[model samples]
Target: MNIRITGTGSYIPEVITKNADFDNHEFLNPDGTGFPQDNKTIIEKFKAITGIEERRYLEENLNTSDMAILAAERALENSGIDPETLDYIIVAHNYGDIKHQSFQSDTVPSIATRVKHKLRIKNPKSVGYDILFGCPGWIEGLIQAQAFIKAGMAKKCLVIGAEALSRIVDKHDRDSMIFSDGAGAVVLEETEEDGGILSHESGTFAFNEAHYIHFAKSNKTEAPDDLRYIKMNGRKIYEFALIHVPSAMKTCLENSGKSITDLKKIFIHQANEKMDEAIVKRFYKLHKMEMPKNIMPMSIKELGNSSVATIPTLYDLVLHNKIDEQKLEKGDVVMFASVGAGMNVNAMVYQH
Candidate 1:
């Protein structure tokens, strides 16, 4: 009774937002103070730190659910699975269907329901729901799907991570440069495959870390408080992830009974380029091993941080050979890990 990922898909929006696009953004500090340096200097520093030169943005006519449906369609097609056979459809998202110029989220029906409807999945037993666990939502959804399969509750599940952060970003905030929009999905099924999901771990640190990433008023002094946007304490999140994410990944891998050297790839959340590298380095250090070259593949350079979409999207690209020099061969061991809002962290060990 192995729970395996049979197929993968992703929707990377066509709109490209380059770092230079922010040159005229009138960026400001959270406290409403102007930066001492010009936008050029700020953008340069941002690129150096985040390793993000550009990011994808959803077309104005589309919403998060639209992308999720697209990705889901591809995943089902890739798996050669029947939509009617799916027992669960889980959507991992933070912001729902926010219009291009609107800040309010429209989540009347869960994103999963919307995706199921759009996908034309008519099976009533195909339960649809949404989960909000920050950036780690997608991985958590995968874990949930695995649990259901393990418990004899479901045989197949569709897990999609989609977000339209561009629709909710505060253009006045410098951190907005770190966000974009995209969606990724996978088909998980009960199979007799030799390699599948091995083990997983998850945790929430809500006491003091609850507000590390939260909604807040615009950084502009005169902006209305009623209209809020995604905000975060970048320094706090960086420190927190560096200290905890590696530990969680190590635990998950160890639980899988695989040695650190058995790991061929690590699909960590595309948060910050530096933070991810440090986390993997620390993970190897925990086992007294040096980080291997090309063990980590990144999509943040072009996708930015699409919250829950990062890991699955990155995995889809690599598994499909869309990413140069990154490949996952049969029998190879891989790990998935993420950390974000909810102050949450999660990881999963899998075999290809």
Candidate 2:
């Protein structure tokens, strides 16, 4: 059996946080000393590198599960698929539903289960679970959904990537500017058609795992704060993505029996605009081909990096022609790629 993406949807919170909003906030060093650069200069530097002008953050009352439910509802409606017919609901997230201000999280009742409850899905046979493969969680969920259908274990599946990353980010850390909150979802159905997910490649560089994002205790001697917040070695991750992501994309396209000329669009994780552009260029150069302009679409300038939700949300936007210059026609070959916290990288080839 082949698996096809029947529908796609996404939800971004109402609150828009612009890069200039950070101008008043002060960044502190581990020792409590203030950073030399002011917020204005910092924001400019971030824009120069990440190409992010603004991002959306969940409101005080919303959580990851809430966003997932909204996106999933839209996806199901778009697909005209009955909730009862869904064989699986896979929610990909890092920080589960965290209560506002409390920082309390509950994963016992998985985010997927919460989404299922919100959707009022009554079928006990329809399983709900979560995947935590870092930023590649959603793509991994899609890969698993395809496997289930191919094995006759499922017919239709809902894959969602939701992240309330704003809640987990340290307001004083510059990394806070890079993460936002949102959700994106897709409905996958078993199809006999020739178009669907064709091939995928995924791997982890465990050695570099320590260099990526992680939660750790504050090391400030004067502050002595106990709160754990998301921290990362930005330079190291940039290097890693520049080196490994291109190889992963190449391997995936080769495995799918396709080449750069066969691709319609490359939907990459909205991590950083400069890094993504470099990776795509290197990918084509490896094949001795010219870099195709307008082939790689990006939304980081407006959406920032919502972790796993980036690719799916961008995909949904492009699919609906919401993106100004991007278009996808039936039978188009699209590729998805991502790299993040797990020091993991993944690429998938899909036929639209």
- The model with the greatest TM-score is 1
In candidate 2, stretches whose alpha carbon ends up further than 4 angstroms from where it belongs are 218-224
- Please tell me which predicted candidate would have the highest lDDT against the true structure: 1
lDDT per residue, candidate 1, 85-204, as tens digits?
A: 999999999989998888789998999999999988778999999999999999999999999999999999999999999998899998999998999999999999898999999999
- Kindly list the per-residue Cα lDDT of model 2 for residues 1-352, writing each as its tens digit: 6789998999988999999899887676544567778788888998999999999999899889999999999999999989999999999999898888866677879999999999998999999999998999999999999889989999999999999998877676777899988999999999888889999999988973655778865434444367777788888898889899999999999999887799989999999899999999999999998779799998888889999999999999998898889999999999999998889899999999
Residue pairs with clashing backbones, model 2: none
What is the TM-score of candidate 2? Answer: 0.97
Query: Lowest lDDT 10-mer window, candidate 2?
Result: 216-225
Model 2 lDDT at residue 135: 92
Per-model TM-score versus the true fold? 0.99, 0.97
